[model samples]
Target: MPDQPFSLDQLRIVLIGTSHPGNIGAVARAMKNMGLADLALVAPRCEVQTSESISRASGADALLVGSSLHESLDDAVADATLVVGASARSRTLPWPMISPRQLGAALPAELSRPEARVALVFGREDAGLTNAELQRCHRHVHIPTNTEFSSLNLAAAVQVLSYECRLAWLDAGDTAPARQTAMAKGTAPAGEAPFGEAPFGVEWDNPPASHADLERYFAHLERVLVAIGFHDPERPRQLMARLRRLYLRARPDSLEISILRGILTAIEKHTGRR
Candidate 1:
């Protein structure tokens, strides 16, 4: 099969509750630099298109003219196929939750699709997105940052995200093209399939896991497996592979994964396994 045709310009980045005209201008500049010109503003708290904003926009003034202004999120995302909410809080409401890097990895697939319109929604710098506002999204995201204080300025967030989008779409010329199956000559099966699907059906070798809580979950799992004789010192590695397969096959979603970890603890104590 032929590779899919991807166009980065199809992606749109939307901002909500933006408080500074200067930031709005900077965001326009950011989007332009990334080859993504579709920008939408939802109820900006500051005056837009001001001289300051235009000055910051530099040559990206065309984006300012093309940008849409709305009074609500519903209007802002009216035509979006994928909605990516940007925030530093994890527990926010939304669908398709992910981090900046996760979003970064998946954006190309979306932007590549014909007529696809992806939106990166940013909230106010003062309070970020409220739970209700985030719930409207198909997914939520948190930009990885200092745990002690995980906050980002509105314009800065736009800059970082747009930068990544630019690298994904425009950086194609900088490196050698990847040798996908279709790109290679002759008929041959790639060994990647096996590595892609471990013992179970873990489609992704390193599917997103809760890094903050995974260590503790793994420790509990190991302890229980040890008590149940599922994991023995002689062949602990083999047993772990099975457990890995189970998790992979299940493809436990973010919430389901959390529940599974909890169930593991209960099973350990109930069966006297750990």
Candidate 2:
């Protein structure tokens, strides 16, 4: 437990079907790093307190001592009110996802609500939470990742979420909000200004694009739009805004956008050759 205790008494780190001893140990290290102390094991495939786990834990032995053993997940988090199942992809179970920041902001309210205890649940290394397992939790959390290659280590996921909860706990229950300043009348910046977006508005961090890339994207958009009958020479600007919106929505990753421009060049060549 942290000196100030940021979590509900029912807070538990439940690992289901964990097959690797080192991962369990790493999880202990991760939890301790973020000031979380409770751990629960559910149907683990290996010895939970092996030398590998202890060694990987680094210096989190105190938290490891109280690690609870459970034959099943239901026993592990049966008393928890808010159960967040960490996953990399969607499944049959429709668990709504909130980003780490959103989770941090919302968890304190959820944990403080009457009769609700918050618990963060992690799945095994080989396989994550099953539909049956996810149903036990009130909601699911998707860790956003590259769609093409979306895989993450189990312990790393625990580290991210535990950190979020700890932050939320600190922000919600802490009493010392204002600090004295050297000014005539002290006042702090509003709305946790430290985390807000750009004051003038977030422009392209990398200036909208050079003229060349912009023209290339326009040509690509024009080709695709004309092929789909979304554009006409008489009213070229009619679909310009809509085309821009498509690219904005796609957020066409660098590679995808580059490939799109290449195809546009190829198409222009073939059409002009006629």
Candidate 3:
């Protein structure tokens, strides 16, 4: 028997600082159309349940009604295991960037872990996510558009990513069963891989760290660095940002995070700063 199709229940569409109520409704519609249910709103600038929003939502009012609202992005995605932000512009500090198609291809394996919760974060209508916001994401996704008119609507962006996610889900459903059956019968080829394997065929010994876990680790790291005089908050030079990029790229698991935190504690004790 093949593995079950990835569940959209674990995938959340997060909109941050949305200024328009209609855009929120439209986003809800797009998510519902793609069979995605979890919608998180962070610091929405407009009233969530307005006539404009309901009108634009069409028949996706349920999503709007059930959406979770947060005061900050951190609270919105605190439990997510994978957080990917949609960025339209380039920054001085480049993040791990991937195309929309690549994001779709990667979802099946990412959502395979039972505890995994993936957050696809979108920014405001007028401007995108801030540098600080993008830094919090594990990866950044960009949708290539005609340079002549690259201004994609907020809801349209959500629709594009939502469609890609649906496509990946459908594709996984089509292939997973047959692959699992072959493996169960022991007729699979000598190194025949199963569906839903981790990206690049790497198997994890421990589950990936949650967003909260990474946040704690980052705080501990900065504290330890400051204690050792390696980082100076007064005259900082993007040291913490660079270090965050490095650790996020590593995608350390829970055990690794514990070990890293232990080292930080040891350093604090040695420096008598604890």
How do all models score by TM-score? 0.61, 0.60, 0.93
| Best by the TM-score measure | 3
Worst 10 residues of 2 by lDDT: 193-202
Query: Top lDDT: which candidate number?
Result: 3
| Total backbone collisions for each predicted model | 3, 0, 0
Q: Report the Cα lDDT for residue 5, model 2.
A: 23
Model 3 pairs whose backbones collide: none
Q: How many clashes does the backbone of model 3 have? A: 0
| Local error of candidate 2 at residue 104 (angstroms) | 1.1
Any idea what lDDT model 3 has?
Answer: 0.88
Worst 10 residues of 3 by lDDT: 192-201
* lDDT tens per residue, model 1, 1-274: 2233346666778888888888888888877777778888889898888998999888888888888889888677755656667867656212355767666656544444354466788988788887656645555667777899767767678878777766655543232244343245433334333212321122442323332233345567777777876778786555554454355333343455577788987897799764
Better of 1 and 3 by TM-score: 3
Q: After superposition, how far is residue 95 of candidate 2 from its true place, in Å?
A: 2.8
Per-residue lDDT of model 2, residues 156-271, tens digit only: 88888888777777765463232223122434333331111221122222222222343457666666667756578677653564454344333333355577777776766766
The predicted structure with the larger lDDT, 1 or 3, is 3
